[model samples]
Target: MNEALQLLKKYWNHDNFRGLQAEIIDSVVSQKDTFAQLPTGGGKSICYQIPALLQDGITLVISPLVSLIKDQVENLQKKEIKAIGLTGGISSDEVSNLLDNCLYGNYKLLYLSPERLQSDWILERLKNLPIHLIAVDEAHCISQWGNDFRPAYLKIANLKTHFPKVPILALTASATPRVKKDILEILKIENAVVFEKSFDRDNIAYMVFEVEDKLFRMVQILRKNPEPSIVYVRNRKSCIEISRQLQQSGISATYYHGGLSSNEKNKNMTLWTSEKVQVIVATNAFGMGIDKGNVKTVIHIQLPDSMESYYQEAGRCGRNGQKAFAVLLNSASDYIQAESQFLAVLPDKEFLTKVYKKLNSYFQIGYGEGIDESFTFNVNEFCAQYQFPTLKTFNAIQFLDRQGIVTLSHEFSQKIIVQFLISSKEVIRYMSLNPQQEETIVTILRNYPGIYEIPAHLNLVLISKKANSTQEAVLQILEQLQKKEIISYRANGNDSTIIFNEVREDERTINRVSKFLLIQNDLKTKQLESVLKYVSTKNECKSRLILNYFGEQKKENCGICSYCITLKSKATPAIAVSKQIISALEDTSLDSRSLEKITGQPSDQVIFALQELLEYKVIEILSNNQYRLRK
Candidate 1:
């Protein structure tokens, strides 16, 4: 224990470990697989990060969010620790170099998205690294029954066979009893040490306001609070519109969504974290892995997909132990919108097959032509070309994934650069000889660096800033260079990776898969219903309800809940006034009317006489040129 504390103090600036951090670390040190169900703000990262630093070899953290992996790697690097991240958008050569560094270099941590586990190269390379521990972030995603399951997560259980000696640490902010069991069984952890933290925040005042004008209500809350707050909306358009509205009202605010450039997201997040922006209005994409400690409020503008997601997002507030608020403003249509989103993603076999065929045609691929052939795709253009609904087409793609026909992954826009191999004057002379293609080649050669090295990664923001141009213009110039064969540029694109298994369709096989997909959809709908229940619950303490949902039992109700306030109000009644007190006010301005109103006793004779006189002087007169109480 003392040694663990020393590591905690040495690595991080903390004197002691909070909640189950010590126990979680001890379990890893003792070579026991562990499962931890810590609530938000419970320091789950420290549980794995600290042990990874103290362990014998590298710790591989499998996370679902690629953006989160990138952030974590950067943070670890800032701490003077060697960390490598394996995610899409990096070149294949960069991945090989990174994996080589992890295997041979002194890297303590390696973060990878679950999708990377499917790569054949990754599996081959894993056998060479001296792995000490496996940390699964958001482990609940491994369970098909869980709210946020991914098929890639299911493949993680095979790690036990690859590295039998290393201990595993599974972490999640929210998971039900069933999901908990599923995670444990799927991971094949035997008698894993369990650490569950209570989900209660007495400092947060949970209020549900039934409102029609959600945007106005949100603005009112921000105006009154005047603290760091987050407004969660349902869609990307809402994030943009609400953020604009808040700015128009003179509040320091910004919007965040998955659609924005990575640089834009980083800039907005920095502004909010540095307190330059008082509020951030965003979709669900905004809050994961954000570790700001001074957020005073989390206001939900629409119904979230699940209670787990809502609690995690809402828990971002009041981390500094100050008073904060979590308010949910809802209307009738929000429930319908949420329900429709769930249903739309679950398609029948016929619809799925048709969508798949249409997608192939849209991409201009036939039979076996597209196998292992990668190309940039424009979703809007593809949809227009195929004459299909974008939303429905997207949902159909997800369903096809469940059928195991193809694997889908989101892509990000990244820049590329090359180092100068020849003199700039020589290149210009060469361009003069071949003007048609040489001009484009010279343009790119002068623009980017490290490109001479194969599959080099470049910072698009820095490049654009240096070029004094928009990203669109930079991409157009790159495209022209690619066309001239002076440079080969992979256009930065937004499309899911489609790996076709190309299974021959059988009606029975399709039916079985479609039925399974529908069942999963029904389960998702039930999860959303659970979120609605949390919002509508009025008879229980909000804190107690949340705690109990996460499998914690509290002995008493939090005295600060709306339910407790209602009970207190019911037990106490308005006081009566005493007549003797009314008679004593000899110099008061009241004439006959006050004298008659005060002298008559209603109930509890002594109380009524005193109350009537006080009410008459302070309350009644104040309303119609009333008397003021001097402090």
Candidate 2:
């Protein structure tokens, strides 16, 4: 234990561990099937990484997010610890080399996405490696009820059969009691040591404000707290608008969404992580698997679909144990709009069938022709080509993925530009001749290490930014050096994998499949509604409510939620007014426009207040946008 602690301090620059990290580490070292329910920023990675180093063989980490695998593997490598990742964006040769390293090298960790488990070759390769432990990140994904549920994760249980002696560690930030049970059953982890930390962050100030004009409210928030922050919205278009607003306000800001190319996403992420950009306006897809520790705030301009997602995204703030803020700016229309959007995206059978056929056709596979081939997909292109709307199309694809009809890989690809362009021999000779620029040349060589591998067709934006040079300047140098036969550079692009099942089985045998997908979509919608409930609830400690939802019992009021704070501020007559409003509605069916006249409150305030009441079930919604009291 002391030896591990020393390594922790020596490599991670931490003298003391946070939360239940040390305890979790002990469980892993003891070779127990451990379950860790740590909140975001609780240092979950170290729990397994440390024990993996102490064990005699490599620790196999199964993760759903490829971005997370890249992050963990890179962080480990930076600490001088050997680790490798088998994810998308690599060639078969690379996978072969990585597997060889895992077998022959003293690598402590081998990170792989759960989707890779379907590959028989991968399974066969793993059987020969000396794997000591299996760590499943985002363990909640194994459960059908989880917010980020993935069918591929369910197959991970078969690992026990392959490596019976290896202990398994399941970890997640959020999971309901049902999800917890499902995870244990699906992973077949018996006699597991479970350790969960309190889901409270004293340093994070949570606030929600009522806004009529969302853009105006966002401007105010950015003007007031202009530190490193994230602004989350529902659509890709909003990502652009919000970012433009921030830039107009003189804040260094950028936007990220699925619509952007992988190079753009990586550049934006890099700027945000390096503090080069003060704000990032992005969709929910931007934050998962991100590990930036200095983010001072996270603002939700639009609501997320599930409490699990909101909690995870909001938890990104204050990771460094410093004071931070998370705010939700919402209006009456925002709620209605979000709900309607959710309903609109529910796929019909026709739509699903069309997409299934289109997917097979998209990959040039006829009926059963596309059984196992994987290809990169662009949602916008697919939608445009097939005339499918974005939201419904995305929903349909997600349904297919959940039903094991396909596998989707989400990854960001970037372009690399060379700092000093020169040929191998000429560059060596130039360095040999010009000792003055030798250090600069060497740094450039080390940074653009892959220049020799794929010289042409590379994205030079990132490398240009890293080199502190203009893209043209970097290119000019590369061209000159290449002309001198010292080096070479080029441009390239690649797509993310979204693989489809090729076999067109008999419809009768697979009737359960489409029904199962429909059920999954409905449940996902419900999860999003639950998320809305958490954000809008004013009757319980927000943190405690979140913890309880994640299977944690014995948790008390956080004393920091809006409910507790409002109690301290004294319950105002607003409650009484709300009660009277509910009563009046029960007596007579009325719209907000009519209710406002009787309530004598302004339209926007009355509408906002009424929506809150409706969400709390204080008033039951009736026909034609009318409302009635529950009693």
Candidate 3:
């Protein structure tokens, strides 16, 4: 523990650990398998990283996302730690060299995605390396019951057979009781020490607003807060549109999604992180492994599919322990749309079989073939070719991936990169002929150390600033350089990827998992239904509800949430009438006159209650003007 503390101060420059970090670190350092459930910003990395530094060999970290791996590796490198991240984009030769370096070099940490474990060569290399500890980030993904279950995570269990002596450390931000059990069982950890930090974020005040104009409400919230904020939307189009709208309204904002190039993503992230941008409107892809501690607000423009996702995302705010807000702008239509978009298109067994066969045909794969083969997938084109509904087709693919029949990766965008093909003397001679390109080339060379050796991710914004030119002008100069054979440039491109994990026995493969697939669909439907319930329930404590969903029993209400605040607001006769109407309609439907007679209230009060209920979708008005509970 003393060595661990000294190492922490040396690398992270922190004097102490936060929450359960110290306990988890002590357990791992003592060579015991440990499981940690910490909230966002709970400093989970240090629990394993400090131990890795204290030990002699390297720490093998299995992460689920490439962005996360890249971020951690970059941070570690900035601290002068020898760390390497093995991603899918790297060539086989690069992987070999990286593995060799880990074996022979004094590397402290090596991060790799779970999918890479499928390679026999990689596994053989791992067997030869001196592994001190194994850390699994986002450990909940190993559970089939988890929200973001990846089939590849199941392969992580094989590590027990290979490195039986190495201690294991598993970590996640959100997990239910069942997920925790599954994580331990799937990882084959026996009698592991479990450290659970409180899931409650007392500094963040949760608020759900039922609104008609979501954008208007969002603008109002932003104006009131006037701090670093993140607005989470449903789709890429919405991310762009909402960001533009915010910018038009004189707010410094940017948009981010999986479709953006790596350079663009980094640029936008830098703008937000450096406080150059006041707000970031993004899809769900924006926030993982992001360490912005002073985010004052996190607004969800659309309800997420499950409580796990919503909790994890909203927890991103207030990491610095100051007061912050987690607001959900919702409408009745949002609920309907969420249900239709996620629940309605759940593919059945027959549909799954058809999609499977079509997918194999699309890839020109024969029966009992295509195992471990991956291809660039265009969902729109495949749906168009088959005359199928795009949403249903996507859902079918997702189901297949979840069932381990296939592995579907998110849309990957190649980095915008440039490499100089000419020598320094050639560049100088060309610059003398074309003075307009001189500034851009000079700026690139000054900013990048080895552009001539390999293609490097170039920042057009920075270059434009340094070269005293517009971004368009900088891009044009790079294009000219490419045309003149002075440089090689590659623009960003977007495409989803799919790997067939099994052979192409369409029905036989899918039929075996059809029942399990239906169970998964049912679970998803229930999860979404829970979200709807969270939004529609008017008087319950918001914090308690979310905590209870994660299996935390809390009797006290968080007095800061919107629900508690509204409860403290001056109550009127109409509010009491509305509650009465909701209670009355909970069990059976009743017309206005019947409700009025049962409650012994005036007709006017009954009318007001009915109107309020109808507006909030708490009760639906039937054809005969009778009222019933919605859903």
Candidate 4:
């Protein structure tokens, strides 16, 4: 324990461990199988890291997210601790070399995907390493009941079969009792020391609002609680659009989603994390292992499919414990949209079987011949070629990927390379003719050397910034240049590559996954129903509903939530609130965002008052969506 504390003080510059970190570390160092259910920002890494340093051999960490593995490995490396990640997209040769590094590099930690562990070569090589502990991050994924269930995670049990002496430490930030039991059974971990931090975050005022204009409501919420915040949207397009709207409304904001290139994601995340931007509108992909402590708000513009994911994404805020808000914005139409999106994408057995056959045919993989074959899989192209519904097809492929039938490697194609077909002199001549593209051409030429001789990989964000152009314009210019045969360009943006882990079995393939597919479909339906029940139930406290969903029943109302505030505000009559609003706006017009502050009433009350006043022709809405007394 002394040595562990010393490592903590020396490396992390912390004199002591936080919360249950000390106890979890003690259990791990004593070689006990442990399970930790810490909250999102509860320092889960410290529990295994300190013990890994205390032990004699390397710790093999099976994590579900590549971003998470990269982050932890990089952070540890920054502290001069030897850590390496065997994340996806590496060649077999590279994998062997990385495993060799673990053998001889004195590396204390090796992080990898459970899918990688399913490989015979990787499994065999791992058997030789003196693994001290097996740490499973996102351990909740092992549970069929948990959100984000990855079928590959079940393979982690194989490690136990090989390294029987290794102490297994499973860690997850979110899990119900069912998920906990499921995870324990899947890991083959019995009599393990289980530690769970309470899921109740008293500091976070869980707020739910159903409004006709979600954007208007969101702007109001942000204005009311102006601090470092995140706004989660359902899709990539929303990430861009909402952030743009916020920016146009005079807020410093950015966007992030899976569709963005790595450079863009990193740059945007850095901007928001460093307080250069006050708000980040993002897709659900935005918050994995993201622990920015001072985030004052997390607003979801669209309802997530389940309470589990909503809880996780919303939980990203309020980590600083300083009165943060987790706000969910919804509407009557949003519920209909949510149902269509969630239920439509669910892959049933028949749908799964159809997709299975189509995928194999698309790849032209002969029966029992594509066991190890790999192919470039663009979801859009695949859907277009087969005339499958885009969302349903995507969900089907993902289901297969999770079933260990194929690996849909995202962020596997960030490399954008270009080479000039024409000579430098001809390129210069063409650039002279096309003055509009000259700066971008010059930027690419200057940044990437030997582009005339060979293909050189480049970053789109870097090129755009240097060229003083948008990425869209840059790509357009590149495409134009390609048409003229002045240069050959290849840009793969968030495209996925599929590697078949199983041979084509067609009916047999569907048969194997059918039972689980039905079960999973049922699970998703229930989850969506739970989410629907949550948002539509206007009478219940939002905090209590969410807590109860996670099996944390809180009888007391969180007085700051939308329900509690609304319940309390009903005591004041609508006419009385309207009078206050008129008085507050007597001297000047005000927008909805500011009316709540000036009227000294909750947002719901203020909005209701404004609606009534507008109906009576007592107040008028301006072109800018502000309210003023009628002439």
Candidate 5:
């Protein structure tokens, strides 16, 4: 324990562990199977990383997100700790070399995706390594009841059979009681020491505003706070739209989504994290492993699909234990749109079967064929060929992936490979003829070996730095070389991979997964309803509601939430008026005059309550100036 504490201070510059981190580390170091439910920003990585440093052998980390693996590996490397991340698109030679390094290179950690466990060769190689601990990040995904369940996680239980002497540490930020029990069962962790941290974040103040002009409200909130913040939207298009709007209002802001290249994402993230930009307007793709501790606000311009996602995202703020805010700006139309969108994407089983057949046909795979085969997928091209809606097509593909019929890798930017077509002699002659392009060509040749023999991945940023040029200049030179027939360049883009897990059988496969689909849909509906209830309930503490939903009971009301604040401000009459309006609208539609008369409240109070109901989507206005319960 003393050695672990010394390493913690040496590597992370922290004198002690936070919350249950020290205890979790002790459990792992004592060779106990442990289940840890830490809240977001609870330093879950430290719990395993410290033990990995103190132990005798390599620690295997099973992560679900590629970005997370990359982020952690980079951070560890910055501390001069030996670590590596393995994912798809690597050559077989590279995998062999990486595994060899794990065995002989004295590496402290090896991070890999869950999907990689399907490779028998990799599993055979792992069996030879001396693994001290096996850590599963995002362990909640192993449960079917979890919000982000992945079928591939089921394979993790077999690790015990391979590494019989290794202890396991399972960590997650958010898991319900059912999901917690499922994790224990699926991981086969008997006699495990479970460590659960409190879900309440007292430094964070939750607020939900029912606003007509969401954008306007967002701007107002930004102006009031004017600190480092994050604004989340629903889609990539809105990410750009809201960012531009904020920029136009004289705020330094940028947008980020999964569609952008790796360089672009890193640049935007750097700008925001370094305080060069005041805000980052992004989709939910941002903020997985980001470690910015001074983020003062996180505002959601749109409602998320589930409370689990919402809680995780909102918890990204207030990591420094300062007073931070998580605000939601919503309208009645937004609620309706969210519900309708959910329904629209959930295709029927028949439609799912049709999609399955079409997918196999698109890939030119015969029945009972294509098991373990991978294909490059172009979703737009596939949709165009089938004349299918893009969203529906994507949903069907995701559903199939969840059912283990296929494996769809997340969209990662492809590598840029360049190979010189001309020989070394020809390259020397061309460079002498074109003095301007000589430096870049020479730099590329020197930095990347085998450029003349085979295509090699190149980093444009590194090339430009070595050549004393800009990235644009490097690209221009590469294009010039391509035109002059001096090289072959493949620019980076979105090229995803899909692996077929079984033979193509449309109806049989669909029927087998139909019950799972129904269960998924029901779970989604219930999750959305829970979110709606959280936003609509006016009498309870917002923090209490979120904690209770996660099965935490006996929690006191957080005095700083929007509801508590309103209560303290003596707004009891308004609450009574809103409840009366909701109860009266349950029977039938009524005009404002009739509602006011029925509730026996003043006209001003009735109008206020009606507006609140409409904004919260508890009621809707009909064409005849009548209000009724929203369907």
Candidate 6:
């Protein structure tokens, strides 16, 4: 413990370990398989990171997201610690070189994706290295029941087979009981030591408001809590729009999204982190690597896809042990919008089967063949030939990727992004003048939402299908429209690559995994419904509801949430409140609403106080239902 504490102070400059971090570290250091479930901001990384620093040999870390891996590697390198990350799109030569360095170099941490384990050579190379510990970040992804399940994560169990002597440490921000079981079982960790911290934040007040104008409500909230704040939105367009609106109302705000270049992201982040900007309006992508703790408020203009996301996002604030707020705003239309965004885009079993077969046909792969065969996938051409919807078809391909049927990799250097520079009416007039281009122009406007507000990646094949033309024709029309300054377009070479991990009996392959697919989609629906219920429910304490969802039943209601504050105010007999209400009516006859404001008590408490006076015959009700002291 002394040595671990010393290393932590040297590298991270922390005086001591927090919460279960030290216990989890001790377990891992003793070479015991450990599953640690801590909520966001719980210092889960320190549990394994400190052990990695104290261990004799290099530690192997498997994480899900490339961005997360990159950030961790850079942070380690900043501390002058030797660390390396093997992310996707790297040449085999580079991977071989990095592995060689890990074998000989004084590297303490080596981070890579779970998909890398698919290569037998990589596994063989890893077996030769002196791996001290195996840490799996976002361990919940290994579970089929988890919110962000990835089949690639299931392959992490293979590392246990290879490194028979080393310990495995799994960490996640949130996980239900079912997900926890799946992780331990899938990882094949026998006699696992599990450390779970309560998923409760007492300092933050959870609030939900139903309003017709979310923007106006947001403005009011910002004004009320004029401390550092974050407003979460769902799309890039909303990020820009909300920030601009906030600025117009004299609130210093900035916006961040994935579409922004690295420079823009850094600038905006710097503005907010430096306290120069009071608020940051952003999509979900804005939260990675954020360590600011003074954020007094977190307001979500759009609901997240699941409770896991909601809890993580809402947990971002109140880390400084100060009172903070997590606000969620909803309108009547958000329910419909949520369904369309989540359910409509989900690819069903039949659609998934069709996508798999078409993919096999497009790649010219025969049944019982094509394992380990990789090909550059031209998504536009395939979608055109099949006349499939771009959004759902892409989702189906991704589902296959997750199920290990194929590996779908993207090369961001090449993409067809477009945004219309002119209004639809002006474009309609232009299209009528040049009727040859009408179909292509109309198709782009319809398929791509937010094309007018933000640049969107377009599936050229889908556009061609809608226009009843060829990809070449569509590209030509796009170029012509760009030349006329009607739209902005950017494109490069191929977009994605697909490698078949299984033999190409497409329908049978999909059928084999259909049950998992069904369960996952159903879970998505249930998760969304849970969030919907949490917001709509007025009687239950919001904090207790969240804790229950995470499989922790709190004995007492959190006294600060929107529900508890009212419930607590009314739970006691408001004798003083009754006297106050009576005194307010003594000067003149007054209605319940006026007494409410005059007494400065909650509506329920004030009404109960008035009722007590009426029942005791100490007050009289006028014909207009106004309360008056007994005459």
Please tell me which predicted candidate would have the highest TM-score against the true structure.
4
- Report the candidate with higher lDDT, 3 versus 6: 3
lDDT of predicted model 5? 0.86
TM-score for each model = 0.74, 0.75, 0.79, 0.83, 0.80, 0.74
lDDT of 2 by residue, 1-631 (tens): 7988898888888888888998999988887899999887677888898898787999999987766787778878898899999864455578878899889998889998776787788899999999999999999889878766777788899998998888999999887778888888888885689887766677776766655556665666677777789988888788898789778878789989865665577788999888898899888778656778888889997777777777778888888888787777776577788777887788877778778777777767765455556776777788999888988988888777655567665553434444334447877888788665455456566665766665444445655666666555665665656676565444333334686543654353146466656667788778777767776776677666666666565455656555566667643366665865876776677766567668876444565677779789877767686777777
lDDT of 4: 0.85
- lDDT scores of the candidates, listed in order: 0.72, 0.75, 0.85, 0.85, 0.86, 0.85
Q: Give the TM-score of candidate 3.
A: 0.79
RMSD of each: 11.4, 8.8, 8.3, 5.8, 7.2, 11.1
lDDT of 5 by residue, 429-473 (tens): 998999999999999999987888889999877998999998768
For model 3, where is the 10-residue window of minimal lDDT?
Answer: 407-416
lDDT of candidate 1 over 35-125, digit per residue (tens): 9988788888888888887876899899876657877888788878899988655656888899899978989998987767777688778
lDDT of 6 at 177: 93
Report how far residue 35 has shifted in candidate 6, in Å: 1.4
Error of 1 at 215 (Å): 2.5
Q: Is candidate 2 or candidate 3 better by lDDT?
A: 3
Clashing pairs in 3: none
- Which tens-of-lDDT digit does each residue in 28-81 have in candidate 3? 989999999998778888988888888899999998776688889999999999
Off by over 4 Å in 1: 1-16, 88-98, 116-124, 366-375, 398-516, 562-564, 568-631
* Stronger candidate by lDDT (1 vs 4): 4
Q: Compared with the true structure, what per-residue lDDT tens digits does model 4 show for residues 223-329?
A: 88778999998787888889999988778899988767666788899999899999999887777778788999999888898887888888888887788899888
Shift of residue 513 alpha carbon in model 1, Å: 5.5
